[model samples]
Target: MNASLESTMRVKSSTEKDFLKLSGVNAVDVGYKYVDGKRTDEICIRVHVTKKKKTVYKKEMIPAEIDGIKTDVLEGTYVPQMLSPKAIDELLSDTVKYRPLKGGISIGPDRSVGGNIFTGTLGCMVTDVATGKPLMLSNYHVMCIDNGWHVGDQMNQPSLIDMGTHADGAGTLLRAVLSSHVDGAVASINSGINSSAAIVDIGNVAGTATALLGDAVRKRGRTTLLTYGFVDGLNGTVNIDYGDGIGVKTLTSQILIRPDTTINPRFSNSGDSGSTIVNGDDKVIGLLFAGSSSAPFLTIANPIGFVETELAVFIEAGLQPNLSKGGLENE
Candidate 1:
């Protein structure tokens, strides 16, 4: 790491509280500075806000530079990327049941409280380190709708939100972790449901890796399908609304992504949660969980390393089932 970047990170940590207290501020992180809409080599402290106001109170104004470290303000309001009832209703026609269920497709809890339906992407397939049982990965919010859900709660592909009452049974929740850093969960694949190791559009993952700043990445999600992006910020601390009793959560050490304009305009959208983000080499890097409402959408993910450690699962060295006939194949 460059000396200047290290210094900027330190300053960002020391002054994060004061910056977040400012009205409209949503997150704080370290990233390259941008000038005239183009990325610059200079590293700076990034202050993400829900809205970039034309003017603000003198006390709430963010300095151009903090401790001689440059600061950039970005517009963003992060929220869990689960499909809403309105979206589900509109996308009902797009839902399709997969025989050999695989990554990048829609999945959700068997049901939601009060008959509500929800949908999120099935990230990928992995094996439990302790039990060696096959499991599908997703988000805690996607698998465990609320505190009422337990470890054995059933999950469905195409999701109840997408397929209504016709959704088929898929897996059962095995473990989940919602903490200061990660929002991840895994479900044991039930009998008769064949799952593939490869993501829908992306090929078999090479393995896990640390997501570095500016690394080109992509994800196959339920709503967005396959979209390209790049890591723009690291070690981000942001506030996310998980809805209802779960409420707003403060997530730390997040990987921040910005859309790759040359390819896709939006890297993620609602129902993209639980998508696995991989680097150019098809190496798993992060787990998509939340994103901002910004133009092109600013995707947020927990580092894949953190998700693996927290969930006690190994993704890269796990399953290697052959893709079914007429199924996705790695290039």
Candidate 2:
């Protein structure tokens, strides 16, 4: 992340040279412009900055005010990468650095999304399955409002909670890698990411397998990074309520670990929607999403197969090519 780039926007001269001078900025461009009766307080600036560089893939982002909100975007062929929990935390702490950065990855607003920087508890991964293209994924509702691409002046990424910063005391910092733009349809699928993802075994249970009651498991969340718990139940369901009169009810659950009131192993509160939930063996068993408060409550996670299936469909459709070549060739 180099240094945190703060500020969602700044009034800059319409020249590329002027925008580059903004703190945390890498570059700038204009996506569109409109002055309406409702846009009295809006700010607009098209800026670009380098986010990732792999021998196979390199990318940049531009800042634009979407509906009066200052934000970065991935247009045409760009991808969104992720920052590790430590990196994100450090940047968030340095308001000056974060504000001037001039760009950020967009999380989606699928029903599965809990929250983001506004509420913190979100660190994400967006990846291409074919050649293993990379991205930092999150609930988009926080990144863009209804995916309309609104432009405006703001303090930070929409709805991002920064749970690490808001935490009361010492807490674990999660790690995540950001790097690419995911297919817009990834969130539209009911089954979650499809089989396009490599079935890497980090712990137990193995891809989509249900865990026995009391099995120890851990998961890596974009916001909280990694946390552990025990499988509490099977074939369970929870009715989770969210803002906008939206929520997931009778939502399926593959794990029900013993409540961790003492140490809060679950990674997200409300904002870490869609994070991966794995067993002790490191096999992602479910998607760690809606919880009571980014920490407690009987968390509801979607089946791993669901996510894989969605990703697979996007891959087969040739949405985004995995520039990394599935790690077959190192940069």
Candidate 3:
């Protein structure tokens, strides 16, 4: 780490807890400061607030600078990136069922709430470390839903919420990791179902890489399809609402992404959770899990290295798309 990052990390380590206790503050991290919507060269501590207020109590007021380092307050409400029932219906017609499952498509557990099934995107394909079998990767909230969901629960493509029925079964939940650093899970693909290492429009992942500030990134997701962004922050901690059973949780050491204005204004949206974030070289970098739907549209993802270590699975990549069993054809 450089001097600026090191200094910011030290300040964050010493003051993060106090900042989190303040009302309206939801996350804290180190990143380049922005002025008038343009990023500056200076590194500062970023504070993500659910909403910004014109006036606040003295106790809630965030300082302009702390420990000689600047601070920034961003407004956004972070939640687990899953589609609501109404949103699922609107997107139903477009959710295609891929024969040989690949990365970056609709998928979810067989569970439901108020008769509407849950839905999220599949992140990628991986090899089970213990069994060496092909398994589909996605968020724990998408595959397992809650702590009550057991191993072997069924998963579906296009998700059951997106007009996919039980007949569209694609895999079974094999493992999940809802840790401080990762919100990932893997499912065992059904025997007849084929899977490819290729992401929907991004082609095959070359390998895994570490994301650095200002690095260009891209992802294909269930809701947004293909979009580009930039790594704007790192080693961050954010609070996310994972619904009733899981409730509010804090995730640490996350990779933060901001929209790439040249391509699309928005990055990941709801139902885009579990999308794999890749660097410009097509190397996987992070597993997208949460984000704000509003301005700046900051997306939060778990570093792929942390996810792999937490879930004990290796993301399979670098091979050409397989052509057997009516699976994906390489472009």
Candidate 4:
């Protein structure tokens, strides 16, 4: 290995465990060192931060360099734990059962706690590159229960949150990746179920687009459905609370969403966790996952490119129909 790579590996192996245990620090990773905005072959430490002020001032904190490798710090707000609940009457209604299984619809793991329902949005439909199988896309927390799940676990549309019970199994969890960089998962769609590439209220997706700062975007979510927003920041690092026992997890390389306040102040809510972010032209940009608890709530998402690469799937465009399903159109 190169000297810098060797040094980075050694430093991370020696200090990663201790750094993660520190308060206000959210996550840690290894990457190429950058100087004056230019990439370098040197290895470096990248730290995710929630409470920047507190972390920078902590006594006996990790130094700027360890074993001659530089360190970089990224700061972002922490997300709070909250649930979005639907009306009990709606959950009992038959309309939800009849709704098409498509992007931006409700979905969740087939598990419950003391009768409480958990639900999130289905981001989109992607095809496995290796097998060419259709799969449902969503956040790891939304579909895999933040790593508290197993392959073959049933996935329900309308989620238990919307009253989808075990009897209403919609799909099966195929894979999941819950790391500091992403929170994404996929599931095999049940046979005979109609899955679409169209978003609930946003119509058909054109294609995948890169997220640029200040770009206009929109999303159709289970809660706060069909909201518009702008890409406020990129490569953000934030601390996200995944509830009790799971505690807080740090996310890096995140895309930030700020709602179009002049129109509607909220970009997303709890149940909107798995909604896909799209540009005005309906091109995929990112996968929605978490947001702040208070006003001017900022939304966080994983970049679309990262998600596609990590999941080994492609978020199909509306024009491309599933050839295997008799030309079934994508929603």
By summed lDDT, the worst window of 10 consecutive residues in model 2 runs over 94-103
Could you tally the backbone clashes for each prediction? 0, 99, 0, 4
Give per-residue CA lDDT, model 1, range 31-100, as digits (tens).
8788878889888899998888888889988899878888898888998988868776544333667757
lDDT of 2 by residue, 233-330 (tens): 34332322333433322243233443444456443443344455556554556555444322224454545555455444211122222233222211
lDDT values, one for every candidate: 0.84, 0.33, 0.86, 0.72
lDDT of 1 at 239: 88
Candidate 1, backbone clash total: 0
Clashing pairs in 4: 196-331, 197-330, 197-331, 198-331
What TM-score, over all chains together, does every model reach? Answer: 0.93, 0.39, 0.95, 0.72
Give the candidate order by descending TM-score. 3, 1, 4, 2
TM for candidate 3 is 0.95
- Residue-level lDDT of model 3, residues 296-329, one tens digit each, is 8999999999998888888765865444554442
Q: How much does each candidate deviate from the true structure in C-alpha RMSD? A: 2.8, 22.6, 1.9, 7.5
Better of 3 and 4 by lDDT: 3
Q: In candidate 3, residue 60 scores what lDDT?
A: 88
Q: Candidate 1: worst 10 consecutive residues by lDDT?
A: 322-331
- Candidate 1: C-alpha lDDT: 0.84
Q: List the residue pairs that clash in candidate 1.
A: none
Off by over 4 Å in 4: 1-77, 80-95, 113-115, 320-331
Alpha carbon RMSD to native, model 4: 7.5
151-174 per-residue lDDT for model 4 (tens digits): 999998767767678887878999
